[model samples]
Target: MSALDGLLLERVRGLWETVSGVPVTFPPPGSPAAIVTAPGSGLCPPAWVGIVSLGRSALVTAPDAAVARTLRQALSSVPDDALTCPDTVRSVLPVAEVLGPATLAYVTEGTFRPVPDEGDVEHLSVDDPAVSAFLEAAGPTDAEESGLAEVTSPVFVLRTRSGPPLLAAAGYRRWPCRTAHLCVLTAPERRGQGLARRVASAAVAHALTAGLLPQWRARPAASRRVARALGFREVGSQLSVRPELAHRPTGVTEGT
Candidate 1:
């Protein structure tokens, strides 16, 4: 198998096993060059797949063969090395072919590291006025507010020592398969001062304390850097499908 295949197999195998409650060995030890697991009902979250090799082995928890076929055709053209860059996951998917009406997104998976929290960052309850203000005035748009609303835990925000204004905030919510999904937001104007990492580290440290495996799904390089600073490891890339209309390819598809 190619290196990409091996890497993807390692990541998805564990995830598949966890969700399906089944023990499986990818490529079944020296048999064929390809192994595709038959679809099972136990798989949760409908479907999620990752492609590291064109056809060596497909890492999938697909609901049916039709979806799998479309996914395969779409990803067959992806360069093996492209999967290494998590940002390419979105562009590499054959969204129209796979789900037709649904959208597929590429997201980076990250794991948290155990660390001591910086004592200075303040913790805010879900309804704290500061959290509200931060959500309202901090980001240039309402995206940050929506994300913060999804978080199930108390928000952790870092403030400017010079005043009580928000610098950054981080929190977590339950993700598929019982993992903690972390979200971090920094004031657009105060981005470069290490505030993102500071707030994220606090949230991650809290998550670890709660006996949860913290997951960081990042797309931006800056976000990835903050994740790494909080000691989260880049595990692999994932394809996230949702209920949005996918853009159709006008004619035959182009570059990989």
Candidate 2:
């Protein structure tokens, strides 16, 4: 594998270790990398490189060899344009080959930094009655869902001092290798007020206290800014596709 290819493979391996709770060894030359886990490990698809690790010792499916080769080429040939959002994944894999419905996401990580002004954010218990209300108001987010499914702790949410309504919320899911996936969402009306950064900083602070590396996967410019302000650096990009579209052909357009 080329250097770029090795880097991409390492990215996925780190993610797998986080989610799998087992260290991922490099695949022998030309062999598929693998992981083993007990039930309830919470490995899922649409993660890095579109592979899922079942709790057992096997992968759900390996990438198509042709697709993998294409991706290797894409990673090796970075474009001159550096002013791109969601840069790395697209450089390595075309959307057309991703098929189904997919989204481009920016994956970032950083050493923890604490923000002094966290407002009146509370460490919400999972069973806190207000959590349901908050979710109802925030609508359904992948962050909230992941917290519900995989996190043992309550998510953190910023609330007004008097009324206790949510201004922003931050949560994380555990991964192997002392990593945590961080997510933050601010109320639509409360955006642009730096509320997101405050809550996210609090969450990152907590993750650091626990000795976990926080992973921030954001797609929006505003969210990316918040991540950067919290001292996170963009390390990679992720492409998430619906399972139904995983088998579709690339280089073909609709109505073609």
Candidate 3:
């Protein structure tokens, strides 16, 4: 994990090798890790903000504890008048367990499972049509916000005997922790067909094959179903952090 160190830029290879067919990796190394960094594109925030793909996640650490704290401040330091996403810390830190004030732990660890049979379906592609369909079914999809870096990644699709399968999509990011962020979609007409569960199982299969983790933002209605089918446990709640304390100081005693 020291790959977040300022001096280890060259040593840190991109996670593209294990990433899903989503565009979640950093576009390219813009900052040398020795210079100022642009947001969302570089591996660092202000100075270092690592951007992992949809099916992936990232962590950045300063050279030492002091710098890490400084980096933390930069992330949580937003203006009261500034408009921002609730999740925007805008800082650099390896995403550890759930932080203070966070509703639940977003990162979950589990063994990659197996993909079920999807005869005549489940196509792998550089541009995933399946993933495209998946997002349409799953609201609040980030398929559009995907930076150019993500559009260039690989994608996969899964279908059932029914015309349009219940799920399709791509990964934007992936990491050794086995965490993946992808557009998990279910077909509009395929609800209650149990296709999503199967497709999710297939993704898990691919994950096990690649030695990675298959993570999904299950629709509220489908969350319980997907979790059970994929052998995923409710390790913790995946929360949307509140914006009120978005810029609050870190280490102020988390989980209060």
Q: Which candidate is the best by TM-score?
A: 1
Q: Which residue runs does candidate 1 get wrong by more than 4 Å? A: 1-13, 16-58, 61-65, 74-118, 139-146, 176-178, 241-256
Each model's lDDT comes to 0.55, 0.52, 0.37
Off by over 4 Å in 2: 1-13, 16-111, 141-150, 242-256
Better of 1 and 2 by lDDT: 1
Give TM per candidate.
0.61, 0.60, 0.43
lDDT of 1 by residue, 205-247 (tens): 7777776667666666777777776666554443334211244
Q: How well is each residue in 1-52 modelled by candidate 2, as lDDT tens digits?
A: 5564455346655565555434444344333324232233334343223433
lDDT of 3 by residue, 78-162 (tens): 3221211224442332333222221111222343334456473454554455554555445543434322125222444555556
Query: Between candidates 1 and 2, which one is better according to TM-score?
Result: 1
Query: Which one wins by lDDT: 2 or 3?
Result: 2
Q: Comparing candidate 2 with candidate 3, which one achieves the higher TM-score?
A: 2
- The RMSD (Cα, Å) of candidate 3 is 12.0
